[model samples]
Each structure stands twice: as C-alpha cells, then as structure tokens.
Target chain A: MAIIETADLRKVFRSVKRRPGVGGAIAALFSREYEEKAAVDGITMSLEAGELVGYLGPNGAGKSTTIKMLTGILVPTSGSISVADLVPHRQRLENAQNIGVVFGQRSQLYWDLPLRESFALLRSIYDVPRERFRENLDHFIEILDLDEFMDTPVRQLSLGERMRGDFAAAMLHDPKIVYLDEPTIGLDVVAKEAIREFITQLNRERGTTIILTTHDLADIERLARRVILIDDGTIIFDGPISRLREEYGTHRTLVITLADSYEDVQVEGADLESREGNVVRLRFDRRRTSAEALIRRAMERYALSDIAIVEPDIDSIVRRIYREGYTEGAIGSPS
Target chain B: MSVVFSRPRFRLEPYVEFAKVAMAKEATYRFDVFTNIASVLVRVYILRTVWVALYAHNAAPSELPLHAVITYSTIAMLMSLVMDIDQTRILRDSLHDGSIVLDFTKPMRVPLYFIANGTGEVLFHAVLMIPALALALFFVHIDVPSFGTLAVFLVSFLLGYSVGFCINFILNCTAFWTLEITAVQFIVTWITDLVGGELVPLVLFPAALQNVLVVLPFAAMFSTPLLIYVGHIPPAQYAGALGLQAFWLIALGAVSVVMWRLGARRLVSQGG
Candidate 1:
C-alpha cells in the first residue's frame, strides 16, 4: 500500500494586484484587484512504503507547494491526500508524528542552542520513548558523524555540519516517512556524498519512505530510483529514471580523436555531427545501433587514436523533457 | 464518538519544553540583559527627575503628589519590562524568511507556541529586573502597598502581560499581509505609551479622558497594575478592574485567533 497518496491535488494562490508608484498604491486601497495564480494545478501521485521518489521541477514549478500541502503546512485548494492513513491537514498532529520534514534553506533547530539541546526539545515535542530516542540518536550520530560538533551552537556550525544536524534532527522521532527538500543544496561535494550515503542507508535499514524535491540532478540520480517530473504546477512525467533515458534519452554521442586528418569519414548506424582537425563527433540512437558496432565501423574507416562514448546525463534528459513536452510514449510509463 | 474519544489529549509537555528551550536561548544573551536593565534604570531616572521638577514648579499640589507620581512611574516602568513582547519581531522575521513553514509543520499551534516562548522571556526579564527595581526604589519615595493590595497587583500584572501579548500577537499577524511591521509597531507603541499610562498616570488626565482610557485594553497593560500598586485603585474597585482586564484578555485572544486563521490562509511564504 502507498504510504503517501494525492488525488488531483491543487492549490491556487490569490494575490492582490498593485499598480506602480504612490498613485497606484492609493488607487489599490480604494478599488482592490486580485490576481489568481494556480501554484499546484491538479497533481496526482502515490508513493509506496520504502520507495524513494525524486520530485523534479524547475523553479516555480510547484514542487515545494506540493510538498507543503502533503506536509500540512499549506492547505490545498482542492483534491484529496492521505499519508499513513490520515488526512494531513485535518489530522495534522497525527500526520506530523508519522512523517519528518527538512528544508535545506531553513534550520528548524534553535539558532543559539547547541544541537544536543535542539534534539532534546524535539524528543519532548514528539514524545519519543527514552530508549527509542537514545537508539535513534546513537544510530544517526554514528552514521552522519555528528559527534564532532554536537555541542556547538547551530549558528557556529558550517552549512555542511548544520545540514547533517538537520537530517538527524528530522529523523529523531523514528518517523516512517521523510520529506527532504533540497537537502544537498549549498554543500561541498564531500558533504553532499556523505548526506546521500546517509539517506540511502536510512532507507535500507529502516524502510523509510523518502520523497525528495531538489534542483540538484545528482541528488535525484544518486538517491531516487523513481522520478516524477513537474512543470507549470502539473505532473509532466512519472516513471523510473531509466525510462527517462529510454524514451527521451535515446541519443548518444561519440567523440573520436584521429591519428591523422581525414577528409571524408563515414560510418553506418551513426551520423557525423562535426569534425575539427583530428577530432570528429558522431551521434547515434542506442535503440537502433550499438556503440560497439559503430566503433568497429569507425575503426575500419579511419585511423583513430582515442574514442569515447558519452551517455546523456539525467540533467540533459530532464532538460529535453522540459524543452520538448513529454512525448505520448513517455507519459504515465510504469515505474 | 470514536473520533472524539480517540483524539489525542492536549498535552502541556510540549509547551513546557518550548519554554525551557526559549529560556536556554535567552540565557545566551547575557549582555542584552545587562543592557536592558541599564536602559530601564536610565529611563526611570530621567523620568523621575522630570516629574519632580514639574511638581516643584506647581504651587498647588496635584491629586497625585510628587512622591506618589514617582512611585507610580517606577512601578509602571518595571511592569513594562515584564510585559515586553519582543517575540513579535521574531515572528515577523520568521515569516519574512519563510521559516514559518517549518513552524506550521510542528504539532503545536503557532500562537500558543509564541505565547509559551514569550512567557519564558518574561520570566527571564522578571528575574533580572528585580535588582534594578530595588535600586530605583532607594532613589524614589515609594509607599509600599498592603499585603492584600500587593497580591491584587501581582494578579493584575499577569493579566496585563496576557493582554499585551495578545495585542502584539495580533500586530505580528499583519506580517502575513505586509512585509514591513516597523510602521505598525511604531504606531502601536505610540498609542500604548500615551494611553497605557506608562509615561503619565491616567488619574492626572481630564475626567472624561481618564474614564475612557481606563476602559481601553491599553490601560489594562500598564495602568491597571500601576494603579493597584500605588493604592490609587482602592480594594473596593479591584474586582471591577480585574474584570475589565479579563474581558480584554478574552476579547483580544479571540481576535488574535481569528486574525491568525485569516492571516495563515493568506500566508504566501516567499521562497520554496
């Protein structure tokens, strides 16, 4: 059964229309005008327990709005949602007990207090059993390496250390589900990898359902097996990460460095894109022709010093999906 | 019936925990506490000297003599310190930075959480303000009230804090609509200072103005407690004054709740 489910969830934001300058401001006070913006327009998806799904979207694509609605921070304009068998907004406290949330841009811990104090406050807030709290704390501290600066004030910790602390803070209650929004944002490469490893281990060890929304494609590639693409407040694509490659990610690039300059280089099952000096670029469809076959043909035709085949990264595939709307074959593919 | 019975019991533990954390956080700013105490003493000294000079210039003694006025003013200043609601600024900053969304994710209601936190800060101020208050008493001729009156004053003071907190809470709710709260804060502070009877005793005002101001919630914040402390409000009127304070407490509490609900609906957190 799905631990989190939303059916046609929608949110419309209403904002007052203001004219420029003092005169416009005065006019607005007299006769008000409001503009309606659909921030999250009819999004529907479900996440099974222990499933890691990446909610991918460009800025202002309503990824955060959807997460907010699911976490009961913002009420949806319409539709239904169920997390852990309770309506998030109506049964907020119960839902809060079952789910943990973290935002990279904000620190939920107190700024002036040491991390240990903040964790203690959370323990009381969630009313976790003492033994269980200790167990979870010890587990996360060891995995995230939080003992080094556990007694330092949050304000004094570096952004990387603070994020590690936040992750541990969110999971201290042993919640069944966790929502991480841009958890790896503004971190060094080493810190990002450490966070990703912790997330993967948590899921594997505890069966924690993780729904992550992030602009960092690397986060999605490393942590999420399933991807849900959102655009303009709506779901554009939902499938496995590989399906994104299989459908829109069909083209692969081959770059060859030649031993000597050649005027005409021809190879079957591949189109020559460009050539400069001793280097040549070729594009091919993986479904239609194998890279090995094209390489053999290229070797037969031209003297090559080095050849490299590059598969399109998830970033480019997502960019393509955004550039060209999701094709029919890519829509609603089984994950 | 099952839904009602199964509903979780409202627990005070989390609020107490909030207070504990807030007090710990406030303890870190020891320098701020010292500065606050120093500022309060300086303000009291300046105001006390000004009141003495005014009374000396007037040949005909006022209804409240110089010593009584000085005592009332000092107590009012101390009450202001206890009733200070600086958490409004914290709430506004949280809203501005969009960290308020994290607040909403908590199991507790925002208003209650703020109140609990504010109460903790007030407790801290009260503990530290005692010495400054003691020093000020040595410099001024304060007529100590009877034990019964002192008890009444303490109760009124607590109610006044509630009223003050509600007013500030309502004002902070404006952050949901307007990003700038400084202007609103300035206006509210001006009104509170003028009519709350912190700077001048309400008894000295014209008869009609005094009557009107006494009924206002602003008077409940500072005037009521100060009046009780100085014996200006006799024991006979204690019940009526306490009743007025309770009325404003409930009225403002309801208004803040309504405002919070509306403001939360309109809350468009700036960032994702």
Candidate 2:
C-alpha cells in the first residue's frame, strides 16, 4: 500500500493586483482587485513505502508548494492528501511525527547554540525515547561526520557543515518519511557527494521513504531512482530516471577527429554541430541512425583519426525538456 | 465517554525544553545584557528627576503622593524590561524568511513554543531586574507595600504580563497578512506608551478620562499592577482589579487565537 497519497491536491494563491502609478495605487485603496494563481493545480501522486523519488521542477513550479502541503505547513485550497494514514493538514501534529523535512536554503539549527544542544532540544520537541535518540544521533554523527563540529555554534559552521547538521537534525527523530528540498544546493563537490551518500544510506538501511526536490540534476542522477517532473503546477512526467533518459535522451553527440582536413563534413542522419582544429562534432538521432551506421557514413565520407560517441547526460535531457517542454509521450501513465 | 477518557495527556517537557534553549541563547549575548541594564538605570534616574521637579512645582495628590508616584513609575520602568519585548517576534521573522515551515513541521504547538521561549527570555531579564532594581532604589525612594499587598501585587503582575504578551502576540500575527509590520508595531507602541500608565500614573489623569482609561486593556497590563504595588487600589478592591485583568486576558487570548487561525490560513510565507 502507498504510504503517501494525494488526490487532486491543489493550492491557489490569491494576491492583490498592484497598480502601476501613484494614481492607480490610490484608486486601489478605495476599490481592490484581487488576482489568483494556482501554485499547485490538481496534483495527484502516491509514494509506496521505502520509495526514493525526485520531485523535480523549475523555479516557481509549485514544487515547494506541494512539499509544504504534504508537510502540513500549507493547507491546500481543495482535494485530499494522506501520509502515514493521516491527512497532513488536518492531523498536522500526528503527521509531523511521521515525516522529516530539510530545506537546503534554510537551516533549522539554532543560530546561537552548539550542534549538540540543538539535537537535545529536538529530542524534547519530538519526545523521542532517550536511548533511541542517542542511537540515532550516534548513527547520523558517524555517517554525516558531525563529531568534529558538534560543540561549535551553528552560525560558525560553514554552509556544508551546517547542511550536514541540518540533515542530522531532521533525521534524529527516525521519521518514516523525509522531504529534502534542494538538499545539495550550493555545496562543493565533496560535500555534495557526502550528502548523497548519507541519503542513500538512510533509505537503504532504514527503509525510509524519501521525496527529494532539487534543481540539481546531478543529485537526481546520483540518489533518486524515480523522478517526477512537474512544470506550471502540473505533473508532466513520472517514471524511472533511466526511462526519462531513454525517452527524452534520444539525441546523441558524435565527435570525429579527421586525419585529413575536410572543407565541410556532412552525414545523412546527422547535423554538423561544430568544428575546430581537425576535430568535428555532429548531432544525430539514435533512433534514426545507430552510432555504427553514423560512424560508417562519416568514415566513408572523410579520413578519420578517431571517433567517439557521447550518450546524452541526464542534465542536458532535463534542461531540454524544461526549455522546450515534453510531448504527450513524455508523460508516464499514472502508477 | 470513551473519547473523553482516552484523551491524550498534555506534555510539558517540550515547552520546558524550549524554554531552556531560549535561556541559553539569551545568556550568550552577554554584551546585550550589560547594555540593557545600563539603559534601564539611565531611564530610572531621568524619570526620578522629572517626577521630583513636577511634584515640587505642584501640590501632590493625597492618594498618590510624590513617593507613591515615584514607586509606580520606577516599577513600571522595570516591568517594561520584561514586558516590552515582542515575544512572538520569531513568528513574524520566520514568516518573513519563510522558515516558519520548519516550525510547522515540528509536532509542537507553535504558539506555546513562542510563549515558552518568550517566558524564558523574560526570566533571564527578570534576573537582571535585581541589579537594576537595586541601582534604581539608590536614586529614588520607592515605598514597598505591606506583605499582603505585595503578595496580591505579584499575582496581579503575572496576570498583567499575560495581558501584555497577548497584546504583543496579536499584533505580531498581523505579519501573516501584511508581511511587513514595523509600522503597525510603531503605532501600537505609541498608543501603549500613551495609555499604558508606564510613563505617568493613571491617577493623575482627569477623573472622567481616568474612569475610561482604567477599563482599557492597556491599563490592565501596566496600570493595574503598578496601582496595586503603590497601594492605590486597596486590598478591598483587589478582587475587582484582578478580575478586570483576568477578563482582558481571556478576551485578548480568544482574539489572538482567532487572529492566529485566520492569519495562518492566509499566510503567504515570503519565499522558499
């Protein structure tokens, strides 16, 4: 059974329509005009226990809004949602006990207190059993490497250190589900890898269901097996990361270094993307022409020193999807 | 019957823990504490000189002589140390930064958490009240009431503190709609200073205005307790005065609850 479910969950934000000039502003004071935008428009999805899914979206794509609703920080304008058998907004306190949240842009640790003090406060806040809290704290400290700065004030810690602390703070309660919003944003490569590894360990070892939202596709590539892509307050695609790669990652780049200079290189199934210093880059559709077929066509036309086929990275595929949007085929059937 | 019997017990541990954290955080700012004590002492001396001059120029009222008035003003100044703080400032700030979502994710009552945190800060300041009080006593002669009056005055002071907290809390909740509340806060502070009986005793006001102002919640916060301390409100009328404070407490508490509910529903947290 799905541990979390939302049926047509929606949140509409109503704001006053601001006028342009001082005259219009004064007029607005007398008679107000309100404008409404649906931040999350009729989103419906479900996550089974122990599933790690990436909730991906562009900025203002209602990704955070949906997470907020699920975490009980926001009340939806309409529809229903249940997490761990409790309606989040309605039974918020109970739901809070079952879920943990970490927003990368924000740190929940107290600014003045040491990291250890924050954990103690959270222990009381969640009413965690002392022994269980200790065990979990120790586990997270080791995995996240928190012992070195445990006594340092949170404000003094670097962003990477603070994020590591935030992760531990969110998990010490042993929440069955965790929502990570941009958890690896603005981190060095090393710190990013550490967070990713910790996330993997948490899910695999504890069987914790996770919903991760990030603009960083690398995080998705490394940690999430399933990806749910949304844009304009609607789900455009949902499936495995590989399937996302397979369906939208159809284009391939073929690079060839010519032994003899060619005036203009052309292949039947490919377009010449660029060239410099006897090296040529060509873009082709994998479905239309295999790499061998394209290479055969290219070699027959020109004397080649070396040829290389580049598979589309998840980053470019996602960027293209975001820019040009996906076709109807891009949308996976509801699970 | 079963539902009532099976109702969950109220746990005080979390609030106590929050309070402890707040205390620890407040103590970290050692410089702020010393500066605050100095500021309070300066205000105490200035108020003393002003009151002495006014009493010398005009005949003092029988019920509220110069000494009684001085006691009222001195104690009111000290009360403002703990009472003037915007206890729910964290709420407004969190809303501004959109970090309030983190607060909502915790399995705790946000309002109670704020109250506990605010109380902890106040308790820390209450400790500072000692040295400040001692310093002020040196500058001005403040009459201490009898033991019974002092005991009743303490009870009245707690109620007044509740009244003050509710007023501050309700005002801060406006951030849910306005997002920027410095202007509202300024206006409220101005009005509170005028009628709160902190700067001047209410007994000195005109008889007609005094009757109306005494019933206002502003008076309930500072005037009621100060009046009790100075023996202006005698033991015979302690019940009525304390009852008025209690009534305002309940009334404002209910209004704050309503405001919080409405504000929370419409909260447009600044950004993620």
How do the residues B119-212 of candidate 1 rate in per-residue lDDT, one tens digit apiece? 7777777887788778787876677888989999999998998899889888888887888888888898899999999899898889999989
Q: Model 1: clashing residue pairs? A: none
Against the true structure, whose TM-score is highest? 2
CAPRI band of model 1? acceptable
* Residue A302, model 2, lDDT: 91
Which tens-of-lDDT digit does each residue in A165-258 have in candidate 2? 9999999999999999999999999999999999999999999999999988999998999999999998988889988888888888999999
Q: How many residue pairs clash in each candidate at the backbone level?
A: 0, 0
Worst 10 residues of 1 chain B by lDDT: B1-10
Cα lDDT of all candidates, in order?
A: 0.85, 0.87
